[model samples]
Target: MTLPASAPAIVVEGVRKSFKDTDVLRGVDFDVPRGSIFALLGSNGAGKTTLVRILSTLLAADGGKAAVEGFDVGAQPHKVREVISLTGQFAAVDEILTGRENLVLVARLRHLEHPQQAADQLLGRFGLTDAGARKVATYSGGMRRRLDIAMSLVGEPRVIFLDEPTTGLDPEARLEVWDIVRNLASQGTTVLLTTQYLDEAENLADRIAILHGVRIIANGTLAELKRLLPPATVEYVEKQPSLEDIFLTLVGHGESVKDRS
Candidate 1:
């Protein structure tokens, strides 16, 4: 799909990566609009994380160009690092540390002036204020995921890469994290996440790119992607609403995004 003339937050072109005899990414390409959520979907071993690693500057691409916020990821690695954060598939917080401690540790490492205040503020933003002193070992899967993403935000990054941010979250918790991501985008931060969940891509992503066989087979808005499928021949006798339908209705009524930044 053709994007507008606005500047892109991410630009990837003809990117390639290989692992020994295997080619993981074969000339993948896409652009992410600034201040929007872009999702990468792929089957297992389809090179989603490899592309993310290249974009996040954790791994090098064998060929082609990648830039984040206009800084060449290959040529200006440090500059690229300055503008983005990454949350991996699993929680990155230390199980021994309390939620607040985890934030303070990350904030102090980032050299924030008021580490404690920064930690407290993040706890409140992620709805962990009441559990601030509890060790992460006691935290639920959803709570741990929230803390992980919160830690990634300690630096107020312009962009964040979430590798399945809601992997193990329950429906209610998934909605909570969705709110966090939406709130982030609403406040002008670019969010790029690789997810296996189709509903997540539908609910959160402004654009979706599907990776298959080391290449991006599809890239576009949800509507555009739907158009790629052949029209359904079967008529719907009486379509029933999904759980997500009910959830969206409830959330639409009372959701509020308190600016954490």
Candidate 2:
């Protein structure tokens, strides 16, 4: 089926999934605008990953419809797979392979021309040029995550699913991944991010949807969600830098601190 250029990159309507007796998602619906970052915010066990799996064609939904790049995820899974990529909570990299090798492997699998060149370009694009030759086992968490994301981009997929992309990273590493995510959207890749971090959704999403009770409890831009709260009473207080702010500042500015990555 042909879709207009203005159609959303992803569409989920009444999508439902159940694990035996447990209902994970119930009548979930959302639209992800092309070239935008859409975050699925929820606590653990909220079925965020389940929803991603269905949308990415990794798992079949029990009911409802989902499409990626205008292809039905259930009916045209192969076509959906052609235009989408999935990166799970953990960094999926081969420990024995060098970062460059990993990227090259994915490029070759995608049948891209000059796999080596593709890998090198991605290494540089993701700031992994210096670590490209090192075994992934030797990579820091952030580097591994970067390489994982780079692999996902091998085919220039129109939609990318990132499930808890920063689950096990330090603050610095999280910031690194955040920048990469922002860059992805800037380059017109539709990103569906499933994260439990409120600040993460606030920091990255163009629109955020809160999933709870097997349903989407809230959906809107951050500003719109914030408006749901009672009007703020005017107050005066000295603003203090957050611990994250201080850590980033000091760690970035301090010359003698050991590398924590």
Candidate 3:
């Protein structure tokens, strides 16, 4: 079914899911606008992954409904799969294959008209052209994760679900992935990101939703969410740079003072 351009890229209404006896999601609701980033923020066991699974058609919702690109997830799973891509918590790359081979494999699986060209283009796009011939097993965590995300783009999916894409990456690598996500949104791809990092959501999401106790406790843009709390009272104090700030500053300029010594 052809949807109007104005339709949301993804929509979920009263979505509920459960295990044998425990409820993972209770009437979750949200919508992702086209060409924007929507972050689902939650701590562990908050049903973020379960929600992504249902939206990506990997699992079924116990009740309610979800539609991706206007195709019903439960009733039109094949259609939903056709327009979406999913990246999970860990890098999903084949260790035996070279970076280029991993991309080529995904392109071939997607049955692209020119898999080699597609793979090469994606390799360059993700800054992996130089490492394309190296075995994935030899790749760094960041490199492997970049390749994994590149593979997810083989078909130019309109909607991408990134479930904790930066979970295990180092700070620098996490920033790299953040740049890639920003680029994707800039290029008209709607991204649904589930992350436990508050900074991640604040930095990337056009709108953020907090999931707690199996329900959406809050949902709004960062500024709007901030409004939910009482305004801060003005105060003067000596400013201090955090350890992370000091670390990143040192790294940005090269070796730390200690390393030089």
The number of the candidate with the highest TM-score is 3
Kindly report which residue stretches of model 2 are placed more than 4 angstroms away from their true locations once superposed. Answer: 235-261
For each candidate, give its TM-score against the true structure.
0.87, 0.89, 0.90
Candidate 3 residue-wise lDDT, 1-261, digit = tens: 666878899999999999999999999988888999999887789899999999999999999999999999999999999999999999999999999999999999999999999999999999999999999999999998899999999999999999999998999999999999999999999999999887888789999888878998778887776555434443454333322222233225333323333
| Model 3 alpha-carbon miss at residue 181, Å | 0.1
* Best by the lDDT measure: 3
lDDT of each: 0.84, 0.86, 0.87
lDDT of 1 by residue, 134-248 (tens): 9999999889989999999997998899998887778988998899999999988899989877688888999988787788877888777655533434344433333223222
lDDT of 2 by residue, 191-252 (tens): 99999887898899999888878998778887776555433443454333332232233224
Instruction: Give the Cα error of residue 182 in candidate 1, in Å.
Output: 1.4
**Order of the predicted models by TM-score, top scorer first:** 3, 2, 1
Instruction: lDDT winner between 2 and 3, please give it.
Output: 3
Worst 10 residues of 3 by lDDT: 242-251
Each prediction's total of clashing residue pairs, residues at least 3 apart in sequence or on different chains, is 0, 0, 0
Q: Give the TM-score of candidate 1.
A: 0.87
Model 3 pairs whose backbones collide: none
